[model samples]
Every structure is written in structure tokens, then in C-alpha cells.
Target: MTTDTLVMPSVTAPPHSHRLRQVLHDSGYALLSLPVGVLFFVVVVTGLAAGIGTVVIWVGLAVLALTLLAARGSATLERAQLPTVLGRPVPRPAYLPGEGGPVRRLLTPLRDPQSWLDALHAVLRLPLAVLAFSVTVTFWAIALGGITYGLWDWALPQEGNEDLFELLGFDGGTSLRIVGYTLIGLLAAAVLPFAVRAVAVLQAQLGRVLLTSRAATQAELGRLSRGRDAAVAAEAVALRRLERDIHDGPQQHLVRLGMDLSRAQRQLDRDPSAARTTLAGAGVLAREALEELRALSRGIAPPVLADRGLAAVLAALAARSPVPVELAVDLPGERLAPATENTAYFVVSEALANVAKHSGADVCRVEVGLVGDVLRVVVEDDGTGGAVLVPGHGLAGLADRLRAVDGVLTVDNPRGGPTRTVAELPWA
Candidate 1:
């Protein structure tokens, strides 16, 4: 009989190995908080004292302002360090700038709430750091000492000393005592990683709360309000433009068609030949009216855009443009949302129209691509560069349109030549 030997597959470590590494990293971060906290506390305290003490002399006010500025700088440094522990970007808060001359600027930090918040963080970090440092050092010392107790225990004078196992109520026999102490060491080692992580997380959270600025929320709210206003204005302008286009083009053609047909009806009985010519003229007017209507509709939403997407639509636009256009469009295989596509189309259309009208350039380049979750479009031309986003100008309307969709439009046109217009929209 032949015996078959089975080979076992090697087992790999689980996903928790990453967590173990993170805990180790966080432990080092926690330990570092001790020195950073102490240094920050001392600096802020000294500054505050000197500033307050000298305030009656007017120089104190300047000192106090500088102190607050220093506090803000320290908070910024701490903010930079957070990504290692938190694994995400922490946005810096905006500072309110003082207007006018150097004196106003010097005093600006004093009035800023974020600077005061930074000062508060500096003051509070000391106690938190002490707690974190104590936990880390105590756990590590106990764990390492107990883990290697067998080597060091014999070096200690054995006359009056009771072993750790005896103190812990374990039996004092040599073999059992050694096993018990080692078990305690093993338990400490296992708990050390978790303890370090917890303390580090707590300290990081405390810094985040105290150091980060609250002004970001306020700024966003203000931007949203302005965007809403811009949207309403843009919609009003679009409606007026649509009304004007209909009145100027299709409305006039329809009126002329009606007039021609009426005249043809009158001449049919008296002069049949004349009536035929008039009727032909009426047919021509009818066709013109129909063509104008189609063009207007196309301006609103091109049918080809819906069917084939942006690439095909842009190619058509390039072909139709008065000046030569170098077009490069790179989009994903799947279609984007209808709103995104429409906004992008209109922005490019308007920008190109402006370029053809105003920029006396022989050739222009249009580029469109996706950058992460943003859609970026750039239109550049060699033109007499005096483009400005003033009210009543095309660029102003373009800016409003972009703002409505949480996008932005920027124009760069120096006096000599070369105009560049960039529009960015969020893809998702």
C-alpha cells in the first residue's frame, strides 16, 4: 500500500496587520505630543504674559497681536501633522484680513477668532499631552520590563524583595512564579498597542476641535447665497435672450410668410401666372421660417449631443466656427449626467462665440478633460487681449452660469496678446 502525504498551505496574516502597524505609528505620534505640548504651552503663556503686562504702554497691544499670530502659526503646524494620524486632509481656517496700511495689518490677528482659538488650543494641549505621554511610557516600561524579567530578576538582591507574582497573589514557587510573571507581561504587551492608539486618537481629536477654524462653514454659506443670486439673474437673462431670438428671427419670417400667402390668394383669380410666382415666394418664406425655428431649437439643445455625446458635438462646433479651432476632448466611455453635459456645452459655445466675435485671432485651441471629479475646459487664442468679466459682457454671464452649477470661470488676457479662458465644473 502506498501512503499519500498531504501538504498544508501556508497561512497569511489577516487584515488586522495594517491596524497593528497604524497603532504602532499612532503610539509614536502620541509620545511626540508631550514635547510639542510643553513647548507650545510655554511659548503662548510667555507671550500672553508679556503682551498683557506691557499693554498700558501701547506696545503691549502690538506684542499681544504678534503673540496671537504666533499662536496661529503653531496651530497651522499642528494642522499639518494631523494627516499622518487621521489619514485625511484638514482644511485650514480663513483669517479675516485687516484693510488699509501696516498698522491695521499688524492688529488683524488680534481681532481674528481663529487666532484666539489657536491660543486656546496651545493652552489646553499641555494637559492632554501629559496624559498621553504618561499612558504610553508607563505601559511600554511595564511591558518591556516584565517581558524580560527572567534575565533581570536574578540581578536584583533577593534578600527582602518579594517577586511581582507574589504581590499579585500568585504562588511563590520558582517555576509557577516565572510562568505567571511572563503571562502578565504578555497581557500588557497585547494591550499596549490599543492603549497607545486610544490615547493618540483622543489627543488628535482635541487638537482638531481647538485648532481648526470655524470660518470655513460661514464662507461656504456666503458663497452659496451669492451663487443662488447669480442663478436667478442668469435665468432671467436667458429668458430675455430666448425671447429676443424668437422675436427677431422666426417671428419676422412667419409674419412675412403670412403676408406673401395672402397676396398670392388675391392674385390667383385675376392673374394666374402672377399668382404662381407669388405662391413660390410664399413657399420660400415658409421654408425660411421653418429653418429659423430649427436653428433656434438647435441652439437650445443639439440633437446630436444627446445621441453621440460631447466629443461629436464639439467636433461639429469646431467645423462650424469662423476661425480655425484645434479641438481636443477626452471624456469617459460612459455618458455624464445631462445637466453636466448641457452646462459644459453652453460654456464652450459661449466662449467660442466670444472668441470669434472679439478676439481677432487666426486660430484658437479648445481643450476639455476630466480631472478627478472635475470637468476642466480651456479656450485659448492669440488675440488683442483686453477681455474682462465686466457686467453686461459675455464673460460676466459665463461666470454667473458657472457659479449657478458650483463651477467657476476665469479669464487671463494681458494687454499685448494671448487670451485664455478656463471653466471648471464638478463631474459628480
Candidate 2:
């Protein structure tokens, strides 16, 4: 009878034991903030005083601008430091580019609102840093001193040690006093991690409110406004183009077919053979009209795209392209949102159309895939590439279409070779 046995390799502590590491990180941040905060506060305050005091002399303007620039730099450093404590990125504020010559550029920072905000943050941080540093250092020192009381208490002149212990209601004995101090030390040590974390979080939140970019909402609103305008103009243009196509193609064919049938009816009794020929011509015109209508419908929303998904639609596109196209598509089994699929399809269609019309390339490669939560489509061609997104151009229209859906279209076409057009849409 043999006993079943199991053996496992030795391992260190579990990954959740981050209390010590967190405490050390917070403590280090607090200590570093003190001197850095002091330095920023001094520089900013001095610069402001000097700039205002000497403003009539014109030297103040330069000093003020330089001070704001320095404040921006300090805010940037704070943003860089926040991610470790806050666990997320803080985007930098956007600043307007300075126009004109050397002196205008020098005074650019003074006109910016974000630069002033940064200066305010730099000035305010000094007091917050002082509080964090004092609290953190004092807690650590008390905790360590209490924990080591047993080892070092003997070195002290021990005349009144018993009275000290009795005052705390512990027995008047050396062992009791040592035990009490160790317990108090253990309690402080237990609270140290939490205290440091609280201070760090407070400082990080303050920095986030003051130093980080507040323009994201404004930027998004502007994008949506532009996108709405573009969408309206594009829709109007598309409607006009559709009307023109119908007028040129199917509408003319139908009119000619009607005329031919009328002629056929008139000649039926007088000349049966002539009527037959006219009827035949009418039938040909009818079929051509039907074909033109089908093409127009496909341009609007292809039957294949509705039936299958983007994969089948793209396969049909590849089959019909003027030049040889290498198609690669990796999509989810289920279909994407209708708008996303439609936008992606049109982007590819327009890009390929541009290639066929403008780019003199022998072969093109089209790649479509779901990259994370984004629908990405890339159309690349080896051609004489000098593509620019001029207004009213196909690429510009594509950009407008993409912008309407918060998608992006990028064209990478340099002179003397390959052009790569990429369109990305959010999958959601």
C-alpha cells in the first residue's frame, strides 16, 4: 500500500501584497513634491510681481510671457507624474500657435488662458505639498520609532520609565511598557499605508483639476459642428449627382423606348415588318433602361451588401475592379452596426474609385478588419502617387463622410510611388 503524494514548487508572496510598495511610492512622491513645489511657487510668484511692477517698461511683457512658459513646463511635469499615482493619462492642454515674427511668438504664452491656469496650479501646489510632506514624514518617523522602542529604550536614562507605563494604564513594569509600545507601533504601521494613499489621492485629484486639459469637450463640439456641416453639403451634392445620373442614363433611355413603341404602334397595320423592327429597338432600349436603374440602385446600397455582409460585398468589388485587387477581410461572424458597415463600404468604394481613375497602378491591395473596437479599412496601390485632399475632390468628400460618423480618413500618397488610404470607424 503506497501513500499518494503531491509536491509543489516553492513560490514567493501572492501578487495582491502591494501595501508596502504602495506606501513607499506614495511616500517618495510626497517627499519629492516639497522642494519641487517650493521652487515652482517661488519662480511663479517672483515672475508675476516683477512682470506687473515693470510692465510700463516693455521688459515686463517678455518676463510675463517667459513666466507663463515656465509655468506650462512645470504643469507638463506634473501631468507626467500623475499617471503613476492616478493610474490614467492626463492630456496636455492645446495652445494656439504664435503668429507673425519673433516678438509676437515671445508674447504668445501671455495671451493663453491655459498658461494662466498652469501658473495658478504651480502657486497653489506649494501649500498642498507642505501638508503632504509633513504628514507623511511625521507618520513614518513615529511608526518606526515606536516599533523599535524595545530595542532602544534601554539606552535612555531609565529613572522614570515605570511612571511612563503607569500613566498609560499598563502595569508599571519594563515588559508591559515594551509590549504596549510595540502594540501602538503595530497600530500606527497598519494605518501608515492608508494615510499615505489618502494624501496621494488628494494631491493627484488637485493636479488633475488644475493642470490637465479642459478643452476636450470644446474640441469635440467643434468636430461635431464641422461634421454636421460637411454631412449636409455632401448629402446635397450626392442628391444632385444622383439626379444627373438619372437624367443622363435611364431617363433618356425610357423616353426613347416610349417613342419607339409609339412608332411601332403607328406602323403595325401599314407595315408589319417595319413595326417588328421598331418593337425590337424598343425592347433593346427597355432592357438598357432596366440595367441603368439597377446600376444606380447598386450605387446607393448594393444588394450583395444587404444580403451577405462586408466580406461578400468586398469580394464583389474586387471581382469588378478595373485593376487586379488583392482583398483581405477579417470580420466578426455577426454584422456590424448598419451605419458603420455602410460608411466603411463607401470609404473603400470611393478610395478604390479614386485609384482606378487617378492612380496609374497595376495592382491594388484592400484590407478590412475589426481591430479591437474599430473598423479599419486600408486601400493601397503602387502608383504615381501625388494625392491631395483638395476641396470638392473625392478624398475630401470621403473625409467629410467619415467625419460625420466620428471616423477618420487618412491618405498617404507621396510623389513617385505607392498610395495608402486608411479609414477607421468606431465599431460601436
Q: Give each model a TM-score.
A: 0.58, 0.62
Residue 288 in model 1: shift from native, Å?
A: 4.6
lDDT of 1 by residue, 331-363 (tens): 999998787787788878877887888889889
Q: Which stretches of candidate 1 lie over 4 Å from their true place?
A: 1-16, 49-56, 96-99, 213-248, 251-403, 406-428
Model 1: weakest 10-residue lDDT segment is 1-10
TM-score of 1: 0.58
Model 2, residue 210: distance off in Å is 1.8
Which digits, one per residue and each the tens of the lDDT, describe model 2 over residues 124-184? 8888898889888988887998899899978877674454668767665778878877887
Listed per model in order, the count of residue pairs whose N, CA or C atoms clash below 3 Å is 0, 0
Worst 10 residues of 2 by lDDT: 1-10
Candidate 1: what lDDT? 0.80
lDDT of each: 0.80, 0.82
